[model samples]
Target: MKKQITFSIFITMLLLTACQERTTQQIIKLTNPSDFDRVDEPIVLARNIFTIKDIPNKNCIVLDKDQRAIPFQLDDLDEDGQWDEMFLLVDLKKKEQIDIIVMWTDQMSNKQFRQRANVRFANKAGDKILNDVNRLRSTDTKLSQAEFQMEGPAWENDVVAFRNYFDARNGIDIYGKRTKEMILHKVGINGQNYHQLDDWGMDILKVGTSLGAGAIAISSGDTLYRVDLPETSTYHLLVNGPLRSVFDLKHHNFKIGDHQLNINHRISIWGGAACYKSSVTIDGLQGNDALVTGIVNLHSDTYIEEKADQYLILATHDIQAEDQAALGMALLAKSKDVIDVSEAPKEGSGIVSTYLLKLKAENNKPTNFYFYAGWATQDKGYTDKSYFMKRLKKDAMRWSRPIIIK
Candidate 1:
């Protein structure tokens, strides 16, 4: 009877210890007030203390001071093939604090937790005739094709969308939306039976020779040169998420002037944001060479703002598409890396304004930058050019000052 009693006491102590281990909590604080709804902001747990498996079966809850559950999603932002971060989509008032409790008993079924960001790559399988190097086409029947028939890859979030020409010439492009619903569903193939305004969000802006909306280039003396990755280039969808979408495109042995360059490109878009992030890794670059990425100058009137070592904001409000709506586009980078902000005028496409950033590669690591677009017709506040520029500056500052996590 004594042995039985001792065994019972040991089992009870073990149960208490396990319970204590499961109720671990971590607190995150935002120093400044969030200007927009904090969507998919990651709270990465310490890998030493917690493994991916430790995240309870969808039972994680971000709680307020009063211990109420807030909607959140757990995802792998780094795309390491394992879930590692917990994303919180909260509207905390300025200077408010929040608590994230793992292993909580509350299993709240919030639809926000299931929000998705997607990317699609339609492959050409059975085409018998090989098109020319300049031929623009895509195998996917749901994608939009420009007048040039630029068939590449396309991706979108709820608010904004983007696509890259599959051919070897132009840079990345943007698609603006007025509604929060997925617009790719309504954008029919070859611009055939589709709605640009009421449904498709319209490819309102033209890329035309200029960096349509954040296409990359190389600054060679007085010329801004762009390389077109062949349609046969490898593309991979890294992350398709409840909060973020990420993909990579790699081109091997592409000639840029006299040098053959290998490039790795990765693009990511988060929920509730107008801007998408692009990082480019170039294998071959000589000394005194710089990478140029910028917004296209479709309009003659343009405004450039610079903040020493922090950021540079470029804005243009001009007549876009058939409608004369104000369209604002900006490219932001660390001012310290900026070599110069200049314009390269092509005879066929007029003037293309660009930001030149110093490209320093020692061991094949990529140089990073950001590009964004805003259409007045899509959102109310975006009609004002000043408002769009201010939004860019605010976003740059917020990114530089990340939330404090402990």
Candidate 2:
């Protein structure tokens, strides 16, 4: 009689434990329809994509085919207290389909993943102690003269990093990394020594007066004006996480010729990616006004221009880096959006050492493109021009064809 009672109590306790640990899961199906392999391609899903109702924000996770927990981010985009989207970087072979399990529960799991992407911005507002802030404005100073750390905000993944000038230059620069560790967080914290080669990496690009890496401009007829003159310039930090990081540069009351407009430039970078994505949104356009972005052409005499299956690529490779090494820079856009690539003068009232890419501009629409940087020291494979270009071509193809998720 005693043994029977003990066994019955143990069975009831096990049943209660199973119920408490129950997880609601949904099978997510994704297919790669393209012929090329999609490697670590980022997929963002909405909150309501799953059929599960009243999903809790905590204890949410993703599992692969082997039932291994994958690194994923359930981001709260607007920070209104509710989770917004799920961010994941997945791999899929051509025409291959896989099922990913997404599980969530109201209880806690106490799980933490490794961080690979970073978005950092700091300024010396009162005490010059490098206070981190989400928003900042420019005062129209010279290049790299702004009090902001590293001149402005910088974003980085494990592969590469980039920073923009908060001053009048409105220029962008690159930091080719030698290691895969996150370096930007502790870089300026000690002191501004990124120019010199460290154990992690060094600043590789000399921006000068050019468009730097891939800065925006206004091209009207034979004239070009950099996006430096704004009545007010504000910077907003949106996401800083393990898999993705995004920020925005808002130029309020930007006068492009006679058209006064506001420009919002959003830039995002993903983990293990050597490039960053830019989306420019502008309103109030009239007449023949156009938008443009370009690469610095001071050091590279020749550039390769290719029209791929889905996009146009304009690239340059030469001893253009600050370290005097080979650095490959490419700017790509959809085939329908790119009009042509033009060579700007070596010197002018506008800017210098830049080859302009005239882009199709529409009122209240965003212009999108990806800028890639490859330094030889950062990756020895980048020393080969063909390898560098081929890698970018493959990336362009992957960007054109995304994995369809159901």
List RMSD in Å for every model shown: 8.5, 6.0
Question: All candidates' TM-scores?
Answer: 0.75, 0.89
Q: Could you tell me which 10 consecutive residues in candidate 2 have the lowest summed lDDT?
A: 126-135
Error of 1 at 343 (Å): 0.9
> Which 10 residues in a row give candidate 1 its minimum summed lDDT?
125-134
Over the stretch 1-406, how does candidate 1's per-residue lDDT look in tens digits?
A: 5754654464334335435644435555544345444444533344344443545443454555544455555555455765665555555444555654443423332323445455654533212212222324343323434332224566787778887766555467777776676655445444443224655476666666566777766655555467554334555666666667777777667666667667677887767778788888877776555676777665644556657226655556555533467777777776666666666654454335433333334327677777777887878677776788777877777666566554
Could you tally the backbone clashes for each prediction?
A: 2, 1
Q: Which candidate has the highest lDDT of all?
A: 2
Report the number of the highest-TM-score candidate: 2
Candidate 2's C-alpha runs over 4 A off are 1-22, 56-58, 78-80, 124-146, 189-192
